[model samples]
Target: MISNLNEPDFIFLLKSGDTSAYQQLITVYKKTVYNTCLNLLQNSEDAEDICQEVFVTVFQSIHQFKGESKLTTWVYRIAVTKSLDYVRMKKRKKRFGFMRSIFSEESNEPIYDRPNFIHPGVLLENKERTEILFRAIDQLPENQKTAFVLNKLEQLSYVEVAEVMEVTVSSVESLLFRAKQNLKKILGDYYKENEK
Candidate 1:
C-alpha cells in the first residue's frame, strides 16, 4: 500500500514489514545492487550471492539507518561493503589453496585465474576492450576500484560516491584521478607487452 511515498515513508513501511514496501524496495534497487556487486566481484554468481546478502543485511538493519545520507546512498554503501567482503574472502581462499597446493604432492592448480566477465550490456564490438578494461579495473587498489565503479561504471556523481563511501567529495575526486592514472598505466603495459 506504499506506492508513491518518499524514501523516509518507504523506509517506515519497510521497517514495519509491509510486503509492498519490501517489493518496491527490491524492484527499485535490485539491478543497481546487483551491478554494483558484479562490478566489484567481477563474477555473476558471486555478485548474485552477495546481492542477496546485501538485501538481507538491509532488511535486518534498517533500524540502524540514521538518515544521515540518502536512502540510495546507504543502500550503495551496503552493496559495496558486501561485494568487497566477498572479494576479500575469495582472495583469502585462493591464497590458502595456493599454500596447500605447494605442500601437496599432486596439486595441479593454475597459477592465477582471471575472472571472465563480460558485462551483459556491453556492445559486441567493444567486448574485447571491455574485458581489458575490466581486468585493469580489477587490479586497482580497493578504494580506487570502488570509487571508479561507482562513478565511472555506475555513473554516480562524486558527491553521491562520497556519500556512499563515507568520504569527502575531494577524496572521491582524488580516488577517481588515481584510478584513471593506474588504469592507463595498466592498459599501456598490457598493450606494450602484447605488441612484443
Candidate 2:
C-alpha cells in the first residue's frame, strides 16, 4: 500500500486525516516498530501494547511532524521513546511494590518478578548466545542500550540512529563504542563466573 505513495504524498494524506493513508503507514511500519519495542522492552506483551501506542501517537501528532527527518526515522524515535517510557513505568511500579510490601502485615517480600525475555526473532541455533547478550544489554545504562539496540539489532545507519536519538552521528558512534565495550566486560565477567 505504501509502495504506491511517495513520502510527501503519504505525509500529506496522513496529515489530512486520510484513514487509508494511516492504514498504509501502519502496514509498512508495524513490524519495524514492534521489533524495536520488543528489543528494548524485552517483553512481548508490553512491546505489542507500546507498538499500538506508537502508531496512535503518530496518527494524532502527524500535523506536528516537521519533515526534518525521514518518516521512518521519526517513527523510530517515537517507538524508542514509548519503549523507554514503559520501562520507566515498570521500574516505578516495582519500587512502589517494594514500598507497599515493607508496610504490609504480610511477609515483606516483593511480589512481582520479571519473566525471562526471549526475543521472538531469535533463531533456535542462536538462542542461547542471544539470551546471554540480551542479559548483558539489560544491564546497560539507558542511552547505551538505545544506541546498541538501534545500531546493532535494528541495523540502522549511524546517521539514522543519530536522527532517532536526536544526537550527532559522532555521538551515536561514541555511544555504540561505549556500549560494545561495556557489553564485552559484562559478558567476560559472566563467562568467567560460569566457567568457575
Candidate 3:
C-alpha cells in the first residue's frame, strides 16, 4: 500500500486530513521511527511511547512541513527531537527527585538506577555488548549521541544525518568522531571497574 503511494501524493493526502493516508504513513514508517527512538532512548517502553508521540506531532503539524527535504528526513528529525526532549525531561526529573529527597523526611533512595534495556532486535550473542554500548551512548552529549545513532545504528548516510540534524556534514563527522572517543573512554572505565 505504501509503495503504491508516491511521496507528493502521500504528503498531499496527509495534509488534506486523509485518514487512510495517515494510517498508511504510520504503517510504512513505524518500525523505522520506533528503532530510531529505541536506539536513542535505550528503554523499549519509552521508545514505544515516543514513537506514538512523534506521529501525533507530525500529524498535528503536517501543514508546516515545507517540501525542502524528504518526508523521511523530516520524520527522522522529529523523532530525534522528541527523543532528546524525553531524555532531558528524565534527567530533570531525576535531579528534582534528588532535591526533593534532600528536603523530605523519607530516606534517600538510589538516585541513579541503570535501566535494563534490551533492544528487541539485537541478537542473543550481541545483547550483552549492545547493552554495554548503550550505557556508554547514554552518557554522551546530545549532538554526539544523535549523530552516532542516526549514522551508525540507523544506517543513514552522513548526508541524511546532516539533513535531519540541520547541520553540515562536517559537523556530523565531528560529532561522530567525538562520540566514538567518549564511548571508548566510558566503556574502558566501565570494564576496568568491573574487572577489579
TM-score for each predicted model, relative to the true structure: 0.94, 0.94, 0.94
* Model 2: per-residue Cα lDDT over 18-81, one tens digit each: 9998888999999999999999999888889999999999999999998988999999999999
Model 3 alpha-carbon drift over 4 Å, by segment: 108-114
lDDT of prediction 1: 0.90
Alpha carbon deviation, residue 39, candidate 2 (Å): 0.3
lDDT by residue (1-196, candidate 3, tens digit) is 3668788888999999999988988998999999999998888889999999999999999999998999999999999999999989988988988887898888556676448677788899999988888888889999999999999999999999999999999999999999999999999999999996
Question: In terms of TM-score, how similar is model 1 to the real structure?
Answer: 0.94
Per-residue lDDT of model 1, residues 1-196, tens digit only: 2367877888888899888787888998999999999999998888899999999999999999888888898999999998898788878888988898899887987655545778778999999999999989999999999999999989999999998998999999999999999999999999999996
**Which parts of model 2 are misplaced by more than 4 Å?**
108-110
Which candidate, 1 or 2, would have the higher lDDT against the true structure?
Answer: 2
Clashing pairs in 1: none
Give the whole-model CA lDDT for all candidates, comma-separated: 0.90, 0.92, 0.91
- Candidate 3, residue 95: lDDT: 90
